[model samples]
Target: MIVRIMGEGQVRLDDVHLAELDELDDELLAETRSGDEEGFRRTLGALLDAVRRLGAPLPDDALEPSELILPSPDATLPEVREMLKDTDGLIPG
Candidate 1:
């Protein structure tokens, strides 16, 4: 799967990592739902960090479509809330 961290470059993640990412995605959604600002920050950062840790970064010029597009580390609660509204899971299925 190809994941894109907005404002950053793309990454290529294997299907094997999907379950782990899904867990992090759930945590992000929970934090947003609970309106826990700190949790949101921590979880969101952790989720993005996990993506970076587990996936291989694509070249800066890569043009493949991303399967999952996540918010940047500095994203705000409102921004994430808007993203979650898509109902595609944080990792977007």
Candidate 2:
């Protein structure tokens, strides 16, 4: 699946990593819901790092639609909360 990290472009992640990503996504959701800013940041950073480490970076010119969209690394908690309200975490299960 193609995952987009806002403000950082896109990466193509394999389906094999979906389960692990989902677990991190769940942690992110819980952190956000409980207003745990530190935990949220840590989890978000881990999630993004996992994507960067495990996925292949797409060429800058690539225009494929992303299957998942994640917040920017510096995104505020409130921004993430608003984003989560519109979807089921960062990945569409």
- Maximum-TM-score candidate: 2
Q: Which residue pairs show collisions in model 2?
A: none
* lDDT for each residue of candidate 2 in 1-93, tens digit (9 for 90 to 100): 899999999999999999888899999999998999999999999999999999999999998999888999999999999999966788766
Query: Native-vs-model 1 lDDT?
Result: 0.88
For model 1, the superposed segments whose C-alpha errors exceed 4 Å read: 86-88
Model 2 earns a TM-score of: 0.95
> Please, what are the lDDT tens digits per residue for candidate 1 over residues 3-91?
99999989999989888988888888988878999999998888998999999999999989988889988999989999898585687
Tell me each candidate's TM-score.
0.93, 0.95
At residue 46, give the lDDT of candidate 2.
Answer: 97
Range of the 10 consecutive residues with the lowest summed lDDT in candidate 2 = 84-93
Off by over 4 Å in 2: none
Error of 1 at 78 (Å): 0.5
Every candidate's lDDT = 0.88, 0.93
